[model samples]
Target: MAKKKKKDAYIDPQQRELRELIELKKMQQAAAEHPEEVQAEFEKEEPIVPKTFKEKWKNYWYHYKGLTWGGLAGVVLVVWLIKDIFFGPEYDLSVTTATKYMFSALNDSMSSDLASYAEDYNGDGKTDVTYNEITIYLDPEAENVDVQMNAINLQKLMAVFAGGEDLLFVLEQESYDYVCGGKEGIFIDLSALYPDIDIIEGDKLILNDTALGKKMYLNGLEEDVFLCVRDMGGSVKEDDESLSTMERSLDFVENILREEYPDKFPAEEAPADNSSEEAR
Candidate 1:
C-alpha cells in the first residue's frame, strides 16, 4: 500500500468545457430515463423573472429591424425641415410659360437676353427669379391644347392662376383661351395695368378674343401660340407697389422679343404725314 501512490490527474483550462459537456449529456440521459422526476424538479425550480423595460428594449433591438430604419428616417425628415425653413432659396418672382413649339430656340434667346435683368426686388441683393416651362399638346375635340394637370402640376397651375404678387404666367394661345374662357380670374386686364402698352401695334404680336374679353401677344413663329402675362392668383392690385416690377419685367420681355426675333417683330412704322407732303 505504501508503494502505491495516487497520481494527480491534470486538466487543461480549455478542456474544462468538454468536461462540462459530458456532465450535461449525463444529466440529459438521466432526465430522459426519469422524465417524471425531471419534470417535478423543473417545476420546483424558481420561474424565470420578467425582464425590465431596459432589458426588454435591448432584446427587441437585437431582434427587430424596422424600428431602427424608422428612427433614421425620422432624423432625416427633421433635418430636412430645419434646412428648408432656414436656408431655402427665396424667389423674388416666378414666371411660367406654355409653349407648343420646341422651346430650345426660345430658351436660348431668353437666357441670353435676360442674363443681366436680375434685380433685387426684395432688396435682398440676390436675384430670385425662376422660369418654369409647360408643354402643351393639341386636344382632339376642340382644337385646343391639353395639359396633364394632375397632382403637383395641377397645384402649380392653380397657384399661377390664383395670381400671386410674385408670380406671372406667359400662356400659349390655346391655353390662354381655355383659361380666359370663363374670364373668372385667370387673366389680369393688361390694358388696365399698363394703359400705355400699345398691345395692338402693327409691329407687335397680338391676339384678340372679343367673346372672351381678352387680348394678348401671339408668338411670332407660331400663330396658335400666344404670349400673355397674368398675376399668379390674379391678386395684384392696381395700386400695389410690385406693379412697378411687373411693368419692368414685361418691358424686358418685349425688348427680348424685339431683339431675338427682329425679322418677325420689327419696329413700329411712322404714319405718313399727308398734310405736310403738299409743302414738299
Candidate 2:
C-alpha cells in the first residue's frame, strides 16, 4: 500500500461556519444585556462645537470696545485742554500787556530835555543818534534799543546809585546790606513800569551796572559818565542818594541817546508791517 496520504492541516468549511455562528450569538447576547449602560455612557460625553473666526472676533470686540474708545476720548480731551491753557488768546494778551509796560517805562526814563536836543541837533526835524560818535542807521529790522540802554545804565550807574555811607558801614561790618541808601538807579522807583523786571544777569529786562553804561555808549550816547563811575570800582556803598544819582545819570544818557540816535530807540513795530509779511 502506498504510504497513507497526509491529511490537510487547514480547517474544514463546515467547522469555520459553526465557529463564526457561535461568536455572533455570544456578541448579540452581551449587547442585549448592556444596552442601557452603553446608552448612559454615551449620554455622559459632551459634543464638540468649533468656533468660527467671526464669532471669536465678536467676543473680543464685546470685551474691549468700551475700554478702547474711552481711552482715546480721554487723550483727545486732555490735549485740547493743554493747548487751550498755554497757547490761547488769553496768554497772548498777558504777554502783550507785560511788554507794553516795560517799554513805556523805558521811554519815560530816557526822554530827557538833553536827549531831545541831541536828537534835533541837526535841526532837520529828523532825529539822528550817533554811536561811538559815528552815526548808525536805524532800521525797522533793529532789535529793541531800550533793552540795550537798560543793560548799559546798570553797570555805569551802580556806584552812583548803590554806594554811600551806609553801604560803606555795611562793608566795614562785613554784612550784606541791601538798603537803598537814599540813591536811585535808573530802574529804581520805576517798578510800576516794569513789574516783571528782575536784576538778574542775562535777563532781557534786568541789567547789570557795567552792562548798563557800556550798552548806552554803544547805542550812540556821547556821554562818558558811566566810565568815570566804573573807574571808582565797586567800592561804594548802596545808598539812596547814590542810587538817585545813578538814576539821574542814566536818564541823562538815555536822553542823549534818544535825541542823537532816535532811530536806535526801541518802539513797537507797527502792526501794519506785520499784517502782510509771512509768519516766521
Candidate 3:
C-alpha cells in the first residue's frame, strides 16, 4: 500500500487563505483608485427621489415670502396681464385713470350713465345699442407728495396698454410722457381727433382747455387731469366704428354737469358771500 504513497495535488490551507487575502487586497486597491465609480455604482443600485408637491410649494412660497414693494409691483403687472388675456372680451371700452379723489366722481357718473343710456348709431328711431363699457382703476400718480413721477409704479397706465382701453385720463405728466413717449403713437393726436377744437398748447394737449367742451375739474383736487383716446381707436362693437369715444366721453361728462347742475358754472367764481355782505 505504501509502495508509492498516492501522489496527491492539494494546496495547503494557509496558502489558499493567503491567495484569498491577496484577491481581497487587489479589490481594495481598485476601489481606492476609482472611488467616484464605486459611488456611482452604489447610487445606481439605490437612487434618491424628488420632494412631494407640498414640499415644492412650500419652498417656492419661502422664496417670495419676503418680497418688497417693488417686487410686489412686478407681481401686480403679471396679474394684470393674466387677467387681461383670460377675462371676457365683452367690455366695449376701457378707461385707465389715477387719483383717489377724481376717480370717485368719475366712476359714479360713468356707472350710472352706462346703465341708463344708449346711443342711436344708425339713427333708426331706436337707440338700442350696447352702451360703451368703462372700467375705472384707483391708481395714484405717486405714492406720496415727495415721490417723483418716474418713481411711481404706473400699474394702471400699463393696464390701459394691456386692456386696450379707448380712453386715458392722466393726472401726472410723468405718466403722460411715458405713455406718449415723445410724440409716439400710443395716444391719438387730439388735433386729428377734433380738427374743429383746439387742444394743442405748444405741441401739447392741455387738460383745462375748452376743447373738452368744459373743464372736467374734480372737486378737492389741486390740479387738472388730461383726457385722450387710444391711438388705434379701439371699440368692442361693430356699430361703434362711426361712434366717437372721445367725443362721446366729453359730451357725456359735460352734458351731465350742465343738465344736473347748471349753477356750478364758471367754477372759478363762487357766489358772493351773502352772509358777509349782509353783516357789512
lDDT winner: 1
TM-score of each: 0.43, 0.17, 0.36
lDDT of each: 0.55, 0.37, 0.49
Off by over 4 Å in 1: 1-85, 100-113, 123-128, 136-152, 184-221, 231-234, 237-245, 257-280
Evaluated at residue 184, the lDDT of candidate 1 is: 52
Candidate 1 vs candidate 3: which has greater lDDT? 1
For candidate 1, write residues 26-140 as lDDT tens digits: 9999988999998898889996554899877777777776889899999999999999779876655565665444454435444222334445566777666666665554444
lDDT tens string, model 2, 22-79?
9999878877998887688789999743389887778767889999899999999999
Candidates 2 and 3, the one with greater TM-score: 3
Cα RMSDs, all models: 13.0, 29.2, 16.4
Model 3 ranges with Cα > 4 A deviation: 1-34, 37-41, 48-93, 98-165, 168-170, 184-218, 226-242, 259-280
Q: Who is ahead in lDDT, 1 or 2?
A: 1
Count clashing residue pairs per candidate: 10, 37, 0
As a TM-score, model 2 comes out at: 0.17
Tens-digit lDDT string for candidate 3 (1-280): 5444442235577887999999999989989999998888888895433399987767767666767556899999999988868963334334445433344344546433432323443345543322232222234553544334423435544554565534534444544665556866555565653344343422234445332323334433445455554545333232454246645544434433344345643344666768977888
Model 2 gets an lDDT of 0.37
